[model samples]
Target: MQQADIHAAAQTLLSRRLNNRMTGPLKAECRPNSVSDGLAIQHRLLELMTQQGNPVGGWKCALPIAVDGLTDVPVVAPIFSDSIYTTSPCPIIADEGWCKIEPEIAFCFAQDLPHRPTPYTEQEIVAALSGAHLALEFILSRYLQPDSVSFIEHLADCLFNQGLFIGPEISLEQAFQASTIELTLTTASTPEVQHFAGKHPCAEPLLPLFWLVNFLRQQGIDIKAGQQVITSSYAGVIEIAPGDYFTLSYEDLGEISLAFTQD
Candidate 1:
């Protein structure tokens, strides 16, 4: 297929995937084999999303992942403001699209790191963040077997993110002082609870933040003031089953809960 056709088809697929949040395998033709193709598709999808009037309020990012010994660049994408909610019993799914919960940390920027010539220093990046909080990223994929999707294909799918839920804020001092968290993930319908200890993949939680600052600038995107930056998940991925009431308690940071109706 021509490059234009590839982007157009992928954009349409992404629009449907976001509009319905439907759970199923993606159409084979929309899959892109290379990261360059995926990036082209991703940006086209972003444009399509904005044309629909959903403003970009923030972004979610993760460290680079090695796929078959070749390290993929970090995953990054805009987070729609409407999709974000404070800790509450919010409805997650209805007619379609499955949700995955990932425990994570979020930083709210106080200063805008607009496209600039000079690279931002670690101190500059940290200073740009006004506060920190615990958050659960609500992930969704067009593919039913998301895990089986190729790395490039997954990157094109907005890194499998659908929405974000931000908990109460914690002081930056408190945030940087800790590196590990004791997490408890609970599903209300089954009424079962599981506990696990998880830590930041990077020794310093701010490493990804700093990397993101520079990364965005390089891409000609800026980290604006009052916008949030959600780092990678701390705990592993947990797919939200039908009728599941989800709650995540992060050690010392606080907790957030979401209630879902079965589709």
Candidate 2:
């Protein structure tokens, strides 16, 4: 794709979302000849982030995990912006539509990880993490082609990452000694409001991170120390309609809730 194409695609998907258009086929447009293709796409976005008039914040990586009722393994495509907010409920309009809201936990890094390096052990990975928190990440995307299949395609199309509402921080070790926790997601809503609950996927959430560290290493990309990683969650995707209150909670961790109108 061309630079203008990248920018235009980013803007359209950012404003409208990936599901807005019904593109015909789910074909792989971005050739994943090398892992750098994906990383390069990420870097391109990182560069674009400077337009926000601030330094690039931390990293947020999303992985897909199983949920009880949701059969389609919806990719947990999330975005990260650093220190944008702290310990409070922030609001965002996802897809300019009323039915979609997201809440998640995020990790902030005090140190930077290698841009590229060899296989990393769990010890090396744990040492790099700085803190954790319950955050609200609004995910938006539009289908360039029918199937939103390519992870790289999503990367190219802005990773369905549009905005984030962040909160307080906690040490990674404190949450789970082994750097992972299992998550459970639940939601409740009255005619007036709705909320989604999330927790570690297993007894440990860090397992996904550990798995991701290896995945990245195998792909030749190094997860820097200061980057943020969001392990997968079991909360099935919740749809938000207009004029409703929404809350996403991570039991014992934190809660990210918000309210919005259809207009």
Which candidate achieves the best lDDT against the true structure? Answer: 1
TM-score leader: 1
- CA error at residue 27 for candidate 2, angstroms: 12
Alpha-carbon local distance difference test for all models: 0.74, 0.50
- Tell me the tens digit of each residue's lDDT in model 1 across 123-195: 9888888898888787766666767778777777777777788887888987776578899878776767888
Off by over 4 Å in 2: 1-39, 51-55, 62-84, 87-91, 144-151, 168-174, 177-203, 211-226, 241-246, 257-263
Model 1 scores a TM of: 0.86
**How well does candidate 2 match the true structure in TM-score terms?**
0.61
> Per-residue lDDT tens digits of candidate 2, residues 1-263?
55554454444433343224534222234333222353444555455545654344444454443433433222332244542455333444445454454455666656655545566677876777777776655554555442434555555554555455565565576555423323333334554433334444554766666666666555555555555666543353456655555555555555555554332
lDDT of 2: 0.50
